[model samples]
Target: MESIKLHQFVPISGEQKPARVPRRKVNGPATAALLIKMATEILTASPTLRHQTNITLTDLAAAEKVRKALLKTPLQ
Candidate 1:
């Protein structure tokens, strides 16, 4: 599988307020890729955006369970 290049928006103080930063490169199967995407979506959908520092342990545990299950299932 080809590596996926992920980027995040970094706040700047210039004409371009937000700059794209290369976060990481993900090289994995389809299932792993889907899980990563889902986890990112879940974190970004948090209610408290501005003041949120880290995700709750419960949320991380739940995500880990889902990821394990996904790893077992075959990619469609």
Candidate 2:
């Protein structure tokens, strides 16, 4: 199985620490679809982050592409 490097920031006692978070390896089509779904949900739930950039429409369109691609893939 392959792995991706995903860093998460953790705050402890007023200090911000960058930690290397372990993410499940997307070894197959099913895992890819799952990752896409999770990413889309995170983007949708964080409205403030989405609105931070002026190109919210573009961002949303990109996210939509992810969803579409996930739908097209046949999960096993």
Candidate 3:
């Protein structure tokens, strides 16, 4: 009769896995201000402009403008 042996495997050192953190949305006034800024730029630029941005610093204003640009439609 012959005896059988089981083999054990071990993970290599320094092979630490990355930790994932859940993303939390900021709803404070700061975020509101930032979103407002982003929205403002998107609306101010010409619809047919060849350049990049839909909005620009030239369009600085209140949150009303960004919300207006978004319109009644929800983001995709």
Query: For each candidate, what TM-score against the reference?
Result: 0.33, 0.37, 0.31
The digit string of per-residue lDDT tens for model 2 on 1-76 reads 8999899985577565668799965547556667766766776778776677543656767866876786677755
Error of 1 at 33 (Å): 5.4
Q: Which structure is stronger by lDDT: 1 or 2?
A: 2
Per-residue CA lDDT of candidate 1, range 1-76, in tens?
Answer: 9999999887775676555898775435555747765765666667474138567656666767776676776644
Error of 2 at 74 (Å): 4.9
Clashes of each: 0, 0, 3
lDDT agreement with native, every candidate: 0.65, 0.68, 0.56
lDDT for model 2 comes to 0.68
Candidate 1, residue 62: Cα displacement in angstroms equals 0.4
Could you say which candidate leads in lDDT? 2
Ranking by lDDT: 2, 1, 3
Q: Whole-model lDDT, candidate 3?
A: 0.56
State the local distance difference test value for candidate 1: 0.65
List model 3 lDDT by residue over 1-76, tens digit each: 9999888887757877668898986445555556765655566654544135444444455456555554544433
Q: Can you tell me which runs of candidate 1 are displaced by over 4 Å?
A: 1-54
Candidate 2: the clashing residue pairs are none
Residue 27's lDDT within candidate 1 is 38
Error of 1 at 44 (Å): 15
Q: How high a TM-score does candidate 3 get?
A: 0.31
